[model samples]
Target: MMDGASQFATTMLLRPWWLLALLALALLSYLALRRVRGLGAWEQAFDPALLAAMERFGHVVPGAARRIFWPVAVAAIAILALSGPARRIADPDTFRNLDGIVLAIDLSRSIAEGGSLDDAQAAAQMILQLSAGRPVAMIVYAGEAYVASAFTLDALALSPVLAVLDGEIVPNAGSRSDRALDLAATLFSEAGILSGDVVLVTDGDHLTPQAFDAAAQLAAANIRVNGFLVEPTARHGDMPAPDRDGLERLTRLGDGSLGNAADPAPLADTIGKRAASALAKGETAALFFRDYGRYLLVLALFPALALFRRAT
Candidate 1:
């Protein structure tokens, strides 16, 4: 429950500076009425006999309410209308475009052994940073897939969750892009949201034929799968051979492009642009406020109309 003054405050001008001008209008109207009535404009305009002839013999004489009262009332109502009275109101018809992005990380031993897991993690963080203010989810996959973080707009909140992804989390020893893609699709289905992109961060050492099928399905649903191939930055190393063809094929099937983790800035820019474009295609409803000035104008009409009526 609000105190009387607090309740009154919200019912009036949101920007109270306008009220000063409204008060001035009211004061000017009062002063003008006093000056005009003191000069007796009606009396000056007509003779006493003419005024007596205009009044009906059997009818009641016009009182202050029928004369000064209605004009004052009209002026007061007009002043109130101009004062810009407003309150916080909900308008549920507002809309905006928003999209979600899912990051699928391969946690197989190959990524751990090749020492490119950090590369994948770094790529994911970079994507997260580039795609700020967008809903992001994380999935870690080895032989099976696990949701490291649910879909959310707060990318920072999911950073810790992404930091813990490793081969140990999955307990299995194999990598299956099929499993990861399938689970990511299921997450999208459950969330009932349109995603701008699905980012696959992996060495692609264990990509199966089924991964292509999954990518096709995702593409059919308008969810593009972008791939990040985490490669060794050095010229010669014992790093496991990344399945370049597999990443290329998966991205092709998913209507997406493959990116190198070594240089993620371009990839981030590409994904960011595409995601923003995709997100712009859809809109979501939200609550807002509508001004009541027109309603006040309608309300002011009642007192204004009364000014033209004769007293009975």
Candidate 2:
């Protein structure tokens, strides 16, 4: 019960200035009602008994006085509607573009020295291009993770950064995609994005149990982690083969798909479709209060119809 009261107390008026009109309305209603009840200037000029007699004899219609109440009631309802009372509500449609894309590029030795760095960069760039107009973030990780670029709508701003990314840029020396996944989740939280996609571009050479755990956590948080496998060139035979099985399993746990680096169209399409699906299901962060004044205005129709009927 206390919680309910606390929630109700949070309701606010959007147009509080409209409330000042209520004082004027109250005064006018008082005067109008007094006049209807035969308590106006006429009451001062004539005896109370005389007015009572006039009302009794039908010289003054008591029913007409009662009719004034309807209009006053209508005006009060209209004034309240104009005040714009509202409270915060979980309205996913309130932020249609809250669904975003986070590109987590693996900058480990396997990707940088395995002859697949170009493929990783290309895959990142392709996803960014296809995800135009959407809020996109970038995470570059090897032994650790770093947000190369925060959420932004301009793909061009991130394209150049992706072009220059390599395993050497990150001082870390191991592969930890798990850290990347965790960092992506943090990014979404900081940006107030409730649901989004995480595109992991990697050679898939370092898959760990921790990575799978991170993917499951992301899925729980409504963030899908898709895989972009960057196959190494045939000449680089010493590099470990891409961990296709592990990548596929990670994607499955994250409720996402695994795509080949050679063609990013399907991966981009999947991201787009999933984001749209989340939005269609009203899965988004609530960023603002939903105004309920318009709904209150609907109640005014009752008194309005009464006034209309009386006038006719």
Candidate 3:
């Protein structure tokens, strides 16, 4: 049953959108242009020739002497990138070339019902595909969670672990994601898993307050959490997992909670993109585009007039 607490529609995340910081960066870039010895030197060397040439263009006749900023601007922007443009994209995607990752799957009773099996199958496929030869550790939790598969990027070797998931596995343990997440965190903390990534797949149903607490704790660690929700409808063999109130709270905490009403297909695809993007952006684009996109443009519009006459 949906509880009033879960119904409270407050946004859960803290977003520090850097609008002001970006404006400042743009302002600074413009100032840097003012001090550029290269542009000034180039202007001193070619300004006379450029001005004389612009005077020939009928249109330049009106302001021929004043239009000498275009080529210098292009050169400046390219120079900026050469100096450090890739650094600006700030947050770009990254390849998982470093270490093996963990894929913790939910195998509680609910996973077998309500079209959840299909979702489970799809999630498994995505994990294996995305793992890309990185070692993956699998865990299944219903009421109780256990390591079904150890860390191995080889998905083929992990099949035994994934296939063991079923509703009957948990018995009377009761649904508790906290335990599952706790296990994952602990697993990753092991010396071997300390440096790799972590992927968690589950239906955000039957979450207890403890789950959210556990999720909050796990997030504080360096592990990356990605959720794949399996469907909850009755058909397809899903059973009575707990109600929704607590699960909603858990979702708010994990942020990694990815989903579509128990459908893993979309969750897998979306989380894959987000994880890949977040990783890449952090390494390359995040620092740049997150704040410098507009600042870089200031130099462009201000000095573009110089090159326009020449190109024409």
Candidate 4:
């Protein structure tokens, strides 16, 4: 139910039609004054010589000036106060990114050797820093997949989860880029984001038929996959060599570029650009209204107070 005060406020008008009330009063007052003057009684009651003497000394009463100014001024103030005034407040939805980011890290036995996972982690941290607090999700996958954290803007909160990730976190053995990418895609789908990028941090040592199919699916879904191929200088001759050609193809198919872990600047720049574009597109076209009518009412008080002052 609407309160009495709210109902009354809405009914009031700054430019009220009842302002004609003042006009009617002024007309009536003018007619009455004219009739009184026509009767020649009020003027007769005052001596013509006394009125002329008063005018000569500049001590004439300012009744005519007061009538001409105060009523109109007070009415204008009251009318304006009745007109509602408002301020603008920014809407939260307008500033939020419509898309989301999913970081898919390859946490296989291969990344466990020669500090490859460490380098990937460092690169991932840089990517997060560059994001400027866009919503981000994390996926660590070997033969099996595990979600370290869901999409969120709070990097500090996600840090603890990211820190605890290791090759052993996924019980299964071997690198499965296909499973990781698919899971990242699933995360984006579940979150209801139609378009976003998935960053793959790996050595690119293996690529099953499933990986190629997953990349195609991701591309069709408008999900770009970026790759960071981390190949450390210290050679472990026993370990299998990374497939550079396969990594390049993965990036090409994913509609993104493959960057070397040693120089992540180019990849970071690209990711940063995409994030900026998303943010710009997310802003609301319309502004929100905030009521400032009460403050306007305070303004009416000044003119209202002037009503009591003698008109100049």
Candidate 5:
């Protein structure tokens, strides 16, 4: 909720250039006023002294000079209305519930070796099911990144694709979570999403500085990067352990949380809460000010009516 002063602070003119018409109107009004004072063509035909005598004697009615003011008033109001004054207002229908989510799944060889691919897939599925109709996107990354799905309201559209996502599907070898984050940011940019979430479902393998940097960038853009650590049920002695510390740091830098894949409901709920908070903060891509310029036209009606009545 904004105070009156705060709302006034945000007030702006959408068509500020139209305010220049006020200057033109001022010039035209000055010329019209001069013409009214001079009694039109009579001033050109007769001497100034004779015209003064006619006005003094009440022979040439100069009452029309007052009428000139009516038109000037109307034009001034119309110009103001055209300038398009607006102020920020909470519009629930348009701005609320506009936040989106992008799920970035890791398809690295380590996940297959650790045998946590099913857990990763299940975590992704639970998030999609709990997304509450928000437009969701997906990115699958190994050494490289690829968009599995663009933004869509239908969560079912992504289920089939998520079902087939495996470590071998991506031709690349190593895990590059940074590429996943970068690709998620690109998806948000293409879809004009200003604020959203990026949920990373991975075994937290091959974490690097670049991955943290990518998460920082997403945080800067008002997009949180959460992690769903898919711990392996059958751990291999040769395989690297899940980097919980690194994932925690990544989420911290990205201003999000780290949730275990064993229970994905909490992460899904967190995403929902963050989205609701964003809506409360008016941080959606559709956030816009309500233009009050049209209402100003209603004020012009008063002067317009005055001019009309005078003409009759």
Candidate 6:
């Protein structure tokens, strides 16, 4: 508890000079000892704890908790002191093309096919490379949209999530294009948000008018909804499919004749291409926002911090 007070004091001062608390306390101890020697009558008046406590007062009162408060005051202040945010030093240079992005992938039945999954994964890889390790959010859409992952730059962690894209995960007995499109908008307005592009991955077959309307809504919110169609091909009997028709042309739909992912190589190549193009854009990336609670991290520690607290 007293450690917290010391930390708070340091934070309030925000000055390195306050670190001399120990030296100042030592000098005070010398002066006090001199007085004690002068009054040689009452030698037993000072106990060890009392003397030590007095010394601590000299240091802790002014230095230990000069400005800090709150239970996590030490942790919070340390975080602020060590690597201060956006601090401009003498020769400051910032990296180029850094931004947040959200990748809204279609997990409809059509993506279960060979080519669809490949294109989607490739797109993610390319985006990761372009973002220079910026946080990316992941959303999977089918008859509905589910957030598979949250915003992060951990590329390796995202690989397994990208691997599990099938009709099995989301039972798309009938494609709900409207629902999927709405998910796009909902995804953007979520936690750990950053300004970036939104990449929609799906076969052109699912393209419906309603989904286009939803995309337009997202675009209006500075979230660019770019379409990536996994076109149907006759290779190994794989066909092309896209979620929505044109944003304007609802009734008149065009044939989505694209690549055939007979083998995994072609599928991988396609996904890579789309992802590369989208990710290369400096302000574009993949955002994977998740709904994980703080308990997960706290549980790793003595989560009892929340379970029990001071009566006051």
Model number with the top TM-score: 5
lDDT top scorer: 5
Q: Encode model 3's per-residue lDDT on 1-312: one tens digit a residue.
A: 355454333212112343344455556556555645234454566677785676577433332322334554555554443333322222222333334456666666666655566667567766676554455677777778787766664667776656666677656555567778788777776734323445556666666667677777765654545555556556443356534444445545655555543455565554444343343324433422334334566667656654545544
Give the TM-score of each candidate.
0.57, 0.61, 0.51, 0.58, 0.62, 0.44
Error of 2 at 262 (Å): 1.3
Model 5 spans with C-alpha error above 4 angstroms: 1-98, 276-312
lDDT of 2 at 12: 74
Q: List the residue pairs that clash in candidate 4.
A: 14-79, 14-83
lDDT of 2 by residue, 1-45 (tens): 999998797677767899899899889987787767655566679
**lDDT score, candidate 1, position 71:** 68
Backbone clashes for every candidate come to: 0, 0, 35, 2, 0, 44
Model 1 spans with C-alpha error above 4 angstroms: 1-98, 232-240, 276-312
Candidate 3 minimal-lDDT segment of 10 residues:
7-16
* Model 5 agreement with the true structure over 1-312: per-residue lDDT tens digits: 468778788677767899899999889988888877666777689888988888799888754678787688888878888887877565433432356889988888778667788889889998888777678898998899899889988876899998888768889888899889988988888888767899999888888889999999999988899999988877867777889999999999999999998888888787765543345434332256667878888887887787557344
Full-model lDDT for every candidate: 0.72, 0.80, 0.55, 0.70, 0.81, 0.48
What's the lDDT for residue 16 in model 2? Answer: 80
Candidates 1 and 3 compared: the better one by TM-score is: 1
Please report how far candidate 5 places residue 61 from its true position, in Å.
Answer: 40
lDDT of 4: 0.70
Q: How do the residues 65-143 of candidate 4 rate in per-residue lDDT, one tens digit apiece?
A: 3444545555554555445343334433333355567888878776766566677877787778776556889888888
| Cand. 3 Cα-lDDT | 0.55
In candidate 2, where is summed lDDT lowest over 10 consecutive residues?
Answer: 277-286
Task: Please give the TM-score that candidate 6 achieves against the real structure.
Answer: 0.44
